[model samples]
Target: PGPFAVNTATFVGYNLGGFLGAAMATLGVVLPSFLIILIIARFVYNFLEYRTIRAGFEGVKAVVVGLIFAVVLNLLEKNIFGGTLAFKNADFVALGIMLFVLVLKLVFKKKLSAIAIIVISGILGLIFYGMFPL
Candidate 1:
């Protein structure tokens, strides 16, 4: 529960109580973690010189990468593959859009802004799902 929790709370609060609800929900979710991280940051640099602390941080870095990979796989399974890896069940249009964005990233590299990619993807989505429905 980090950014996702904060975002979820914000949206739910907005639905329930407008701007004030969103503000409260975001603060409620973030304040505790913010304080804890603030406290940790103050002492963490001092402890960084110790080998055990450095090694623990390194392990944490690896675990975070693994967790991100797992989440990506889960999203691909549910969205592009329609809950399975079988080709027959795959959503080819969604896969096409993903590949298109990847190709744009590869070709454009740093030239393309995230907003441009988002706009392009949104147009593709509208064309495929809304206008054509195929």
Candidate 2:
């Protein structure tokens, strides 16, 4: 989506020169990648049959999961723990909301929709933070 949208916009911007210019701009951006993929697509498929290549891909997947978990921890630290892991600095209201949602998810299974969770969170946010300002 990102490449398609940007490439299309670039083509349109070529109209700053003319329609031909736009067409050239779009093709210039898209052609190289299309050609490269076309050339390498078969080799890539064959390479995937190798054990070492498959293991490398699995390692990449693990790294991606680790990176995602690190991001979640950083956000949790900054938002709920005030950028540090001190127990006293933790926002209990945010923690309570997180726990409540976790419970709902575990206990209810597929009973709750995303909208319902969001609405419940907002109401809880208002009730906890609105009524009692910390």
Candidate 3:
């Protein structure tokens, strides 16, 4: 519980095969994308010059942005608001941490790194919920 971590391919590989496994897993994860990019690099410049392709890429970008916004809203409703359908409860601490980090980022113009925000939020949670027992 000292540091929060994501269980990525390297983590899984290390869990299964130690250092070598982690290296292999990292290579396996990256190699395909590397080779594909290498193969596509020749055509990508010319492809982007086409008006239809450019338009398609713009459409894709818009859809991706919309999907990201939708996901964030859904998570906020379910986790922070405690069920959008029922509206039965709300997690004030979770909401507070979210708003605090959001306001800090906005006020500072994203000068804060993600790690700093996470550590600060974790400490705030411990102080409010663990140590002081709010």
Candidate 4:
């Protein structure tokens, strides 16, 4: 009526503390970033009304841009070209083409929304893979 399952009590209870450990692990990883964002956003909101603060924001924006560029470059190096190399299939090439088009779209400030892009890609994938008959 409700549910059915096989028993794995030994496996499950053997790591009962694992769930609490995950919470501690997540807080450790995220606490610094959260505190930094809170401090930065608070400072910006507090000071943005002044002319000097506005001038300082422009410098902050340039630093933010450099940080964003470095992050993007690191992501590209790790995901697209690094890690494990596999060129036997066309998935990676397709991903590269999709990424290039998306970057161009963003740079030009094109009027396409993320949902539209995702839906179109999903439909293309379904067409190529064939829908399940049910």
- In order, candidate lDDTs are 0.78, 0.72, 0.72, 0.62
The regions of model 4 sitting more than 4 angstroms off are 1-46, 80-83, 86-90, 110-134
State which candidate has the highest lDDT.
1
> Best candidate per TM-score, number?
2
Superior by lDDT: candidate 2 or candidate 4:
2
Cα lDDT of candidate 1 equals: 0.78
Cα lDDT tens digits for candidate 4, 1-134:
11111123323433664666555545555577779988999887778889998998789889987997799688767766787654345775575567557655764586666467667656755654456311
Cα deviation of 55 in candidate 1 (Å)?
0.9
Off by over 4 Å in 1: 1-33, 83-134
Over 4 Å off, model 3: 1-29, 83-134
Candidate 3, residue 116: Cα displacement in angstroms equals: 15
| lDDT for model 4 | 0.62
**Per-residue C-alpha lDDT of model 1 across residues 63-101, encoded as one tens digit per residue:** 986996699788768866675543343476556657577
TM-score of 4: 0.38
Error of 4 at 107 (Å): 5.2
lDDT of 2 by residue, 9-104 (tens): 576767575877777777777788789989998788899999999999899989986996699688767866675543453477566657576747
Candidate 1: worst 10 consecutive residues by lDDT? 84-93
Model 3 lDDT tens row, 1-134: 11122238778989999999988977787778778988899888889989999999999989986996799788768866664443233465555667677657754896776468768767877876678653
Per-prediction TM-score, please?
Answer: 0.44, 0.47, 0.46, 0.38
Worst 10 residues of 2 by lDDT: 84-93
